[model samples]
Target: MHTLKRVRLAIFLGILPSLVIYLGIAVLPIAISFYYSFLNWDGFSPAVFVGLDNFIEIVKDIVFWSAVKNNIIMMGASLIFQIPLGLLLALLLNRPLKGIKIFRTIGFFPVVISSVIVSLTWGMLYNTEYGFINGILSAVGLDAWQHNWLGDPNWAMVSLCITYIWQNCGFFMVIFLSALQGVSNEVIEAAEMDGATGLKRVLFVTLPMIRDTLWVTVIFSISNSFRVFDLIYVMTAGGPAHNTEVMTIYMYNNSFTSLRFGYGSAVSIFILAFSLIVIYVANKFTNKDN
Candidate 1:
């Protein structure tokens, strides 16, 4: 009985700090946001309770919809390009070749760098006048392809997506590499022996074995894709004609720039809800497969 009491006390003491920190850092703000979502507060004056008005305004806001659409595009682009490229890179590096460790390190270097640095680098690279990309295009007699990539609304989002893929693919490649290592070699060898080759082997054996890891990677990639802000902000500042506005950017502009705290909170709540739904649906299928 004394041992049980001491054990309980030790457990309580260990968890007490975590509970306080969680409430202070995570739970408290979420609660405040939920409370503020129903009120009109400019961050300077008293909050006025305007229940559901913010939500109604959000529904009617064209810019909000545009931001949402842009996020969806970002998410789709990441799904289509980032993970597949990461997987391919991981597969290539998984083999034992001369200086392969150096290649793997190079692939992961971008992820360790700050997003601001990556964005600035890419921004300069996309510069129309004397940027490396345009310089190369002009040098190669493809001057027509050299335009203001970041300034053009049609290309701004695409350009940002490319930068995002370049920045994060390394991290996902590491994740896939770890997961790929866990794949049973004997299973792969047996499949190979049964006449499965190349794409067929990957589809029939490797993919199914790594299904859980793929689902996890996809969920995280989707979340990160949807939450993109720094690259877009540094590169386009939501851009020439608001062509690259995402939900978080919209929220930031409303909360900080426009001083519409209540409205921003409402937008945040919408984003949170949407993201939760997406992750939930994804997990439903993923967990079911378990």
Candidate 2:
């Protein structure tokens, strides 16, 4: 009885600090944000109760809608490029080849490198005159393909998406690689013995086994894409005509630039709600095959 009590006490003690930290750091802020969302406050003045007005204002906000559209585009881009490319990379590197470790490390290096640096590098790459990408295109007689990537409204979002895919695909590639390693070699050999080879083996055997991992990667990529801000901010600052404005960027502008803290909180809440719903639905699909 004494030992049971001691173990219980120890577990409670170990858990107490984390619970306190979470309450203070995460829970408290979310609660405060919720409270603030209902009031008109500039973040410094006395708050006034406005109930659902802030939320209503959000529906009327055009930039909010635009940001939402941009986020959806980013999510689509992640689905189109990041997941497939990451899987392809994982498949290629999963084989036993000399210097494969080096290749894997090199591939994942961009993911660990600071996003600020990646943004800056991509910004330079998109510069129309002297940027490396445009320079190469010009050298190859594709000079007309070069444009002010970050300055054009039509291409700004796509340009940012390209950078996002470049910076993040490798991380997911590593994840897929790890999951690929988890696939049973015996099953693969059996499939081969049954005359399944090449794309057939990959499609029928390898892919089905790794469906859970693929789902996880897809969901994570989707979530990350929705929350994108840093790259867009550094590269274009929601640019030429607010083309790359994501929800977070829109929220930041409302909060800081416009000093509409209450409205910004409302936007944040909407983003949070929408993101959670999307993630939850994605989780259902991801777990369906499991």
Candidate 3:
């Protein structure tokens, strides 16, 4: 019993610093935000109590609804684009080619790059003047299609989706690739021997084997969709009449730009609750699927 107690004490010591940081940075801020959400204050001023007013305003705000719609669009796009493309790339790279390592490295290159740099790179490419996309369109005599990619309301969300897919697909690719490596070669060979090949083998044998990983990736994609702010902020600043605005950016504008820190805190709480509900539903679905 004494030895067991000593082992537990050592384990506690090992995790103590991490626990402290997590509580201080994450838990404390969330607790404070919950308290502040009921008040009315600029960040520096004395907070005045106004229970549920911030949340009430959120429900009535048209722009907030628009931002929620954008978030749903982003989530759908990420699900449709990121994981599927990643799985495709992972499957292709899983083959034993002459330069497989190089291909794998290239496939994962975007994920390692800073999000700011990725946003800037895509922003320049999507620029109206001196942008690669419009230049290509004009050079190919498709001038009618060339418009301000990020400035037009119709295209801003689409542009952001494409940029998001380009920037983050590699992450899921690497994830699926790692999971793919753990799949049994004997099982694969058995499927191959049983007349399974190409897409059939992938759809039937491989995908089922990595189903759990895919579910995890889906959850990651959903959570990442909610947290996406830096890239959109850098590229569009939720502009084009707020067509590309998402919850995080909306919250940021309320807190910092409009100086309604209390309302922003309420928005933050909403984001947290929304994310938790999504994750819960996803978990239930995945459990049922498994």
Best by lDDT: 3
Compute the lDDT for candidate 1. 0.91
Selected candidate, larger TM-score, 1 vs 3: 3
Each model's lDDT comes to 0.91, 0.90, 0.95
List model 3 lDDT by residue over 234-283, tens digit each. 99999989999999999999999999999999999999999999989999
TM for candidate 3 is: 0.97
C-alpha TM-score for every candidate: 0.94, 0.94, 0.97
Model 1 ranges with Cα > 4 A deviation:
1-12
Better of 1 and 3 by lDDT: 3
Off by over 4 Å in 3: none
Candidate 2 residue-wise lDDT, 39-139, digit = tens: 89886888899999999988997878989999999998999999999999999999999999999999999999999999999899999888998999999
Model 1 scores worst on lDDT over the 10 consecutive residues at 281-290
**Decreasing lDDT order of the candidates:** 3, 1, 2
Which candidate ranks first by TM-score, i.e. highest?
Answer: 3
